[model samples]
Target: MESDSAYRSRVRSWLDDNLSGRFAHLRGLGGPGREHEAFGERIEWERHLAAAGFTCVGWPPEHGGQGATLQQQVIFYEEYARAGAPATVSHMGQELLGPTLIEFGTPAQQKRFLPGIKNVTELWCQGYSEPGAGSDLASVATTAVRDGDEWVITGQKVWTSLAHVADWCFVIARTEPGSKRHRGLSYLLVPMKQPGVEVRPIKQLTGTSEFNEVFFDGARTAADCIVGEPGEGWRVAMGTLAFERGIATLGKQIGFRRELDAVIGEAKATGAYDDAAVRSAIARACVRLDVMRAYALRSLGNADAGTAAASKLLWSNWHRDLGDLAMMVRGASGLTVGEGYDLDDWQRLYLFTRADTIYGGSNEVQRNVIAERVLQLPREVRQ
Candidate 1:
């Protein structure tokens, strides 16, 4: 096995060489209002990463990966974020579904799905949150009933990101109707190209349809499509959520901090730095960014040691604060979009940050986990 520093050096060198020329144009491919072309570019970029054996760095070599260590995978993400590489189009598949499959999927299941996912040949969307089940995913009412060899699925999922473009959906449905909220659920990998599955864009306040509401009426999948054992979907879903809260969010912290620095530079150029109050706010933002970075590193250390959870709460809180500070620094200009004073990114980010608190197991619930699991505090009683 190679040393961690050696692996980092190797990945960094590969990115510097392969991503220096035309690849540089791939940066920011999926920013606001450019989803279609950006999606196509991202697919091409994933092909490049797959060809270089960097698409799923930590996955086993037999599964279209280089069989790198977890640290090596982290190095790839950190270096790519620094290089400002285009965002992956298969984020839902690679980050959440792929890991869940690795944990609970059968050998056949892995062999069938891993390659397409790693190569971004079949994009995926998550079907967890519904109109009624937003943060309370356990309340998902989507039903999947056995009908011979096929399971008929019906219901609607709201706030499904990228469903309109996805070729597959990792759907969590209530398989046993009479069971309690968290039980009787089964996760199914449903193909999105089939009939009876409809995706309607849900425009955000930023005027982007990055998310959608998906309706499934008599949608069907083979029984083999179930992930893990029946009624174990909740556990599998939790594992995916843990990955989302742990590694996925950590990968973006450094990039967000870098953006914060750019915001500071913009403020200085605009003479906002001369104001004592603005200077104080920027200084406070810098401190928070540093804290977020430290928490991210600490989370990585815990992941290496196989003990990671407390960092989720820290990250959730700090991310909200960082966005608030950015909006404050941008001031009145933050309200507008599209280029004027670089406010487009700031405004879009501000709107998107509103969802940050809600997704990946809401910050309120994360705090409860931290209090009970990390701090061993008494739980609050509900009247």
Candidate 2:
């Protein structure tokens, strides 16, 4: 195996060379709340990355990846961020669902799904959250029943990121009648373009519609689409969640540093840097970012539930706080937008990070995981 430095060099060289010409315009485009920017163009750029073997760097080579070591994967993300490459459109497929499928999926299932994900031919959205079951995933109320060779699905999923453009969704639905909570649930792969599936965009504060509410009315998929046994969906879904909080987040830390530097630059220009409070906040943000990086590095490949939960709490809160700091740097002007409600990048960051602590897994949920699972405290009472 090549050294980590050699891998980093290779990744940096590729991104620097490729993110030019027609794709040059996409530098720094698309992210958390900005997924709507250059929607079609970003997908094309991601395909370029996939062709270059940049996407899914950590997966084994036989699965259409570089089989990159965890360190090399971290290096890839760091270089990708440093090059100002646009955020990937295939994260749900490449990061979360692909890993889950590799772990729990049958050979036939892997063959059917992995190639599309690797080539960016089929984008995927997660159908785990609903209006009632955002973080408490065990309470997913969607239902899928076997009919002939297919499972008919009927339910609604809310806050599904990028469902508007996704070709598929990995859904958690109850497959057994009279079953409650985590029991009798199954992880099924469902197609999004079917007549039975409807995607309605949900506009966010950033005025982008990346999140969607999807309705499944008799949507159908082959019975072989299930990842694990029918009653074991909860376990499979948990594996996806663990992968969701994996090392890919290191790239986000670099983005945070960029945002912080921009805020500091704004502070200097606006004379806000002279204020002791603003200066102190800048210092704290810098220190917290370093700490988060270290913590993320330490927790890499450690899938312990408590560790993942704590990692989420650490980065989400720090990012949400960074948003607050950006607002502080902007002072009064931050409150207003242009005539067409055009927001500057700082303004968008402030508005978007508001949901950081709430989405994925909320702060409360992370605390519960730490408290009950790690500390062995009594589990929170659920009605």
Candidate 3:
């Protein structure tokens, strides 16, 4: 058996070697608020990664994956981030849905779906958030009624990242009539290219349209596409959300590290480092980043009752503050953009991380989760 150290070294070598040549240009290209950069090139780069069997390193061996250990998985994410590899286009497929299916989907579903995810043959988008139910996922109103051999779906999902480019969407919909909240829900893998589906791009503050509003009007998939039992979609969806904050985010922390390094350097270059206040802020950011990484590594497999909310709260608040600091360091200059509404990287970072505390799990929701689930104070009674 290869030691974790040996595997880590091997991963580093592969990244150093492969991220050269044609792929060299892709490093540091795509990420948050800048998903529109080098779209085709990044897709190809991810395909190259898939060919090398490095895509789903954490999946079990039975599932055509490397079956990497928890430590190795963490190492892979960290090294991959350190290499400045662009954010993966297949992340939703490879990270969230794939693991969810492996745990809850039928053998036939896994056999049919997992390969496309690994090989990047078919891209995926998450259809969880709707205009009516973003953080309150249990209140989803999407409907998937049985129609002979297929489930006809109808609903609108908002803030769907990359739905405009996805081949499939694993959706949570009301399966049984008269059921509300978490009941009567089912997880269905609906095809995105059907006649009933409409994807409209939503332009964000970053001057990029990485998110979309997807309308599903009678969109259909095989009735067998349901993951887990009907009305048990809530459980499956929650499980998938658990994986959403997994090792992949560890790599994201590395990106955060680079951004901090850049901000520190920017502070120095702009002579903001000379200010005692700026120096104090930069030092504080450095300390918080180290704390974030340590907490992330320790909580990779964290199954503590309400600690998930704590983890989300910790990082999101820190990132939002980092963005604020980036803008603060730039002073009035950060408020302006280049020609054609084009934002500089820091400008985009500042603008985009505005939602760092809102998306995934909103800061409000995280606090509620901690208050209700962990502290047992009292769940906010949703009207």
Best by TM-score: 2
Q: Provide the lDDT at 241 for model 1.
A: 75
lDDT of 3 by residue, 276-319 (tens): 98889888998988888888887878855366777788788888
Tens-digit lDDT track for model 1 on 97-156?
Answer: 887888789999999999899987888999999988887787889999999999999999
- Candidate 2 global CA lDDT score: 0.92
Q: Model 1: runs farther than 4 Å from truth?
A: 31-37, 301-310, 336-343, 375-383
TM per candidate comes to 0.90, 0.99, 0.98
Can you tell me which runs of candidate 2 are displaced by over 4 Å?
Answer: none
Q: After TM-score superposition, what is the CA distance of residue 316 in candidate 2 from its true location, in Å? A: 0.9
Give me the runs in candidate 3 sitting further than 4 Å from their true place: none
> Candidate 2 — worst ten consecutive residues by lDDT sum?
49-58
Comparing 2 and 3 on TM-score, the stronger one: 2
Better of 1 and 3 by TM-score: 3
Candidate 2: lDDT of 26? 97
Residue 123 in candidate 3 has what lDDT? Answer: 95
162-223: candidate 2 lDDT, tens digit per residue? 99899999999999988999899999999998889999999888888899999999999999
Error of 2 at 230 (Å): 0.3
What is residue 205's positional error in candidate 2, in angstroms? 1.4
Which pairs clash (backbone N, Cα, C closer than 3 Å) in model 1?
Answer: none
